[model samples]
Target: MIDDAENKEALTSFLQKLVNDSYEAELRRYSSLLATSSRLLTCDSIILVALSSIASLIVDGRVSISREAFIACVCVAALIGASILFSIICQWRIGYKDLASPGEQVKFVEKSWEKLSSDWNIAKSYSKTLDIMYKSVSSRNNKISVLLRISVALLGAALAILLILSLCMINRACAGA
Candidate 1:
């Protein structure tokens, strides 16, 4: 009887250790995901600020272009910037909002580990899907930011060229008269 009890206890200990180790690994992965999500949010904020600045310049008549084209560009940039901001907000709500309290996630993971010992595979699969979704959203955000930056550069260049040409035309008119 003594040997049987000892063997059972050893088995239980081994199982517990396995659960603990898996939970720790998962917790570490979640921490990394949180960090990456935060970084993406910050980058989106910076892009929005830049787009807003460009829109301001256009609204304030600094670009020296026809009202129609200026308004159109400003609208498009504003829409893209707003969409990016919205995406970041949604991702934060879905991925990181509950993780704000320190160590809460770790405790949750431990509890989950205890309850779902036999279902670790399912949990791991779900986690992988969530990670893929995060990456997809992050990639979309980066692409939109790049497009916005290119649009800003092209618009600025066009405005500058228009300004130079207008100045030349005015100079010619004055000289001819």
Candidate 2:
């Protein structure tokens, strides 16, 4: 037979723990999205460097290639660079999601404290917080997803263009042009 005040206090403590854990878990889920973006950025950088290095070698007279091949190399480098730029933008956006900000954290704590310490329900507060955070993450991730898609598409297009142009150059080489 617990008194009513003690029961209320115990419920508040339990709810506080549950809400905090839920919030932390939500933040943890975002880590996976960031990791995926990071891996994509790495791929973009590696391919850009490898392609540009080969292009530079040929373009600088270390190896002779036709003007068409030269053009292809230049185009490939530019396109890959563009892809990298977009990826960088995606990373920048990821860098500043609302939950990452100190001010937002403060606001969240204040709201949680107010709700959990008063007549307000912790579960309701957590529900609303989750919904708001989800919308924020979803909208930002949507844009980042779009940017990643564009980056991938551009890289593919650049590779295709280079392949087509390189094949033409190879034909010319075989014909002793």
Candidate 3:
């Protein structure tokens, strides 16, 4: 019947648009954030590594700072490394199981269409799907954001420690000389 054809077309269009607007949009947003967060943490690690290498080389070859100051610098570098590692782990944490449930959604849509061919039930299912996917992505993003903040804070703390130790090294060397 023409009515059946029209209803099917309408349902298909609605579902497509709903997926695009809700599921795909959320996915894209989360993916972009994940990538940016990962890059930031990676850059932080690289900087920390470089700073550690430089500091070690300088302290070993040039400066004769106190043992306590040297130890503090090493501890700060270790903590920064740990924080960066945690951020990377958090960024990769996601509900992959939830993401793989499009089959369930498909079944639900089929049942809704078979029962009444009404748009209301199909729309409800689409909305529910969108909500579930959004929640999953949002939860993952929140976790990653927290880790990123912690990583940045640790990085800042490490820099502060580096500055203080460098100053101490300078003062000690000058006083001794």
Candidate 4:
């Protein structure tokens, strides 16, 4: 009976430790997601600024921009920027929700481990669920990041084209006068 008691105590301790580790892992995953979301927001801002500058150049006659092309570019940039902003907001909320209270979770897990039979299988299952949640969040973040990068690239290319066109128009006007 004494040996059995010792074995149960050891198993309980091990299960508690596993829970603590899993909670920490979850917290780390949440933090990473937050960081990624912030990066995506910043990238979106940069794209917006570039697009605005392009618009200003065209308005001021610095770049000879075709009216239709300029309008189309603005519309496309706006759509992309808005969508990225929305995604970033959603990611932030998910990260916030997943953030674990280290002290509280540890205490809860310890209590549960003490009361429950030393079942490693239960702890393993919980850890697996946590892993799945982390992966899903990470995948969503990656998709948004990719979209932001593509939008930034498109905005940059459009700006360059506008600048060149504006310069050409100025040259033609000067020659004509």
> Runs in model 2 with CA error above 4 Å?
1-29, 93-120
Candidate 2 per-residue C-alpha lDDT over 1-177 given as tens digits, one digit per residue, 9 for 90 to 100: 335877876876776676666656655655665676678778878877888688678768798876766777778888888888887887784532344477876777786685575533655565566666666676676777788788889888887997798788778779985
User: Each model's number of backbone clashes?
Assistant: 0, 0, 0, 2
State residue 168's C-alpha deviation in candidate 4, in Å.
16
Q: Model 1, stretches more than 4 Å misplaced?
A: 1-7, 64-177
Position 141, candidate 3: lDDT: 73
lDDT of 4 by residue, 39-122 (tens): 656766776777788779978988775675676666657665665655455464433235357897677677777543445545
Question: Which run of 10 residues does model 4 get worst, by summed lDDT?
Answer: 90-99
lDDT order, best first, reads 2, 3, 4, 1
Q: How accurate is candidate 1 locally (lDDT)?
A: 0.53
* Model 2 lDDT at residue 177: 56
> Per-residue CA lDDT of candidate 1, range 11-32, in tens?
5566556545654555555455
Stretches of candidate 3 off by over 4 Å are: 1-25, 55-62, 96-106, 114-116, 170-177
As a whole number from 0 to 100, the lDDT of residue 84 in candidate 1 is: 50
Against the hidden reference, what TM-scores do the models get?
0.40, 0.65, 0.69, 0.51
* lDDT value, residue 27 of candidate 1: 52
Each candidate: RMSD to true structure?
10.7, 5.9, 5.0, 6.9
lDDT-superior candidate, 2 or 4: 2
